[model samples]
Target: MNQSELRELLSTEGLRLLDSLPAWHSSDEIVRTIAELRKAGHSPGLVAAVLSQSKLRAKAASKFGPFAERMLFTEAGLEQATRLSVAAQHAGRFSKAGVKWVADLGCGIGADALAIAALDLNVTAVERDETTAAIAAFNLAPWHNAQVVHGDAESADLAGIDGIYLDPARRDARVRLTNPADWTPSLDFAFGLAERYPTGIKLGPGIDRDLIPDNAEAQWVSVGREVVELGLWFGTVARPGIRRAALVIGDHGTAELTAAADSEDEAAGELGQYLYEPDGSVIRARLIGDLARQLNARMLDTSIAYFSADAAVATPFATCFEIVADFALDKRSLKKELASRKIGTLEIKKRGVDIDPATFRTSLSLKGENSATLILTRVGGKRRALLAQRTTFAETSAATA
Candidate 1:
């Protein structure tokens, strides 16, 4: 949004209109709301701005929860903002290190800053865009210890800051920039801050491992099975003896695996009763071996992420499936066999395979009463298809008991 639109959105009248509007659900509702507002004599800009904000707030709920209702957001700022749950963890790192004040560079709608302030710590949130900075100020207004500044993050004054949190803008013109140098404030500048102060740098999960500093603790975080971002903690913020970690956050809570170095890979072995698929964060952190060892499992193939074990070992690091049958990779024979068993609903999972699940599912033209999961991957250098039944924790427990 532009400067004027943002100003209008934060105005008394604009906020009143936004508050009066219900949650935005679809395009039809938005059109109807626009017509009703226009008929009530609201300006086109104000109506548009308020409606846009309503939609943005609705979308932000997933990231910010209840706080989204009271905050203002720009499209780009909202897109780049960290999830509140994850940001709380970041704040905890600073708080635990006895950091009383922090500078949140590239704060983006003040998400991380908000988390810091919620812990009763002081935060100076910096943003380059004036509109975003204004939105951040509005979002952080309730916190007495937080403030927002519109300026270049690299030049932001850090005179009395106890720690730093840097979330470099990784997108340009709505497109994600893959190279570290392309990020705003640049990786060089962000990393340079860590040399002087305790710092946490938020980066994309697929960041090149070579670029990571040797002294820093690199962490991969996943929220609800999706690997969200990689965080590099340096100086005092880096936990002692922990150089690499995979943090998984789910509905149940959070779990983490830490190591001084990459875990050794487990030996590839024959498929057994169950198959385990490691979470993305575990795979990204190269901690799959740690999880495999916990389950008493081994890799299904030397080069694949899938694991196999003789017993149903429950673990949060991976999803376990019970092996029902294994067969050659021929589609015709597989289809004939499935048809004979009256298997219909299928969950096709694959790794180290070139096939697209959707296209393959359509090709099968499946129709039956039974539901089953399929694992299509390489086994001992040969293509194989394993039909499996997904096993939940409760089912496993009941069966073993």
Candidate 2:
């Protein structure tokens, strides 16, 4: 959103109109709402801006929850903003460390700063974009201890601040930048702050492992099975004896696997009765072996992340599936077998395979009463398919414990 549009949205009348609008449903509804507002004598800019923000607020609900309803967001700022649940975890790190003041460098829309301020810590939220900085100021205005500044994070004075949280701009003109140096407030500069202050740097989960500092505690966080962000905790922010961690947050609550160093690879073995798919965070954090050892499992292949165990294991770090049938990697034969067994609903999961599950399922022409999951991956250097039944951790734990 531009400065003028943002100014209008923050106005008393504009905010009232925006709040009065119903939750966004479809494109037709938005068009109708826009027309109604325009016919009501609202200025074209105000109507357009309020309608756009209404749509964005609906979209932002998944990230910000109730706060999205009251906040202003730009397209780019909303895209880059951290999820509120995840931001709370970041804030917890500082609060637990007794940090009284923090500098949130490159803060977009002040999502992280909101969490930090909610923890009762003083926050200086800095954004380089003038428009985004203004929106951030509005979002953070409710917090008496928080202030938004329009300036370069690289030049922000960190004096007297107990900690620094840096989320560098990892995108350029809507495209995600893969190289660390390509990011605004580059990784080098963000990391340099570690030497002078307690710092936490947020990065993408797919960041190069070699680029991570040896002394820093690197963590990969996944929410609901998707790896979202990588957090690097430096100096006092780093947890003792934990250099690498995989933090998974889901319906089951938070589970963490930490190690002093990267976990070693487990030896590949024959397919067992149960197959396990490690959480994306564990794979990204390179802690699959640690999870494997916990579950008494072995890797399905030397290069793949899938694991096999002889018994039903209850672990939050992985999804366990009981093997019902194993077959050679042949589509026609597999289709015939599944058809013969009257298997209809299918969940096709793959790793180390080129087949697209949707296309492959269409080719199967499935029609049956039974439902099963199919895992397509290599086992002992050969492609194989395993028809399996998913077992929940709660169920398995109750039976096995």
Please write out the lDDT profile of model 2 over residues 72-116, one tens digit for every residue: 899889988899989999999999988899999999999999999
Which regions of candidate 1 deviate over 4 angstroms? Answer: 399-401
Per-residue C-alpha lDDT of model 1 across residues 145-237, encoded as one tens digit per residue: 999999999899999998999999988888888887889989999989999999999998999899988999999999999999999999889
Computed on alpha carbons, the lDDT of every model, listed in order, comes to 0.91, 0.91
Clashes of each: 0, 0
Off by over 4 Å in 2: none
Q: Give the TM-score of candidate 1.
A: 0.97
For model 1 the local lDDT of residue 255 reads 90
Write down the TM-score of every candidate: 0.97, 0.96
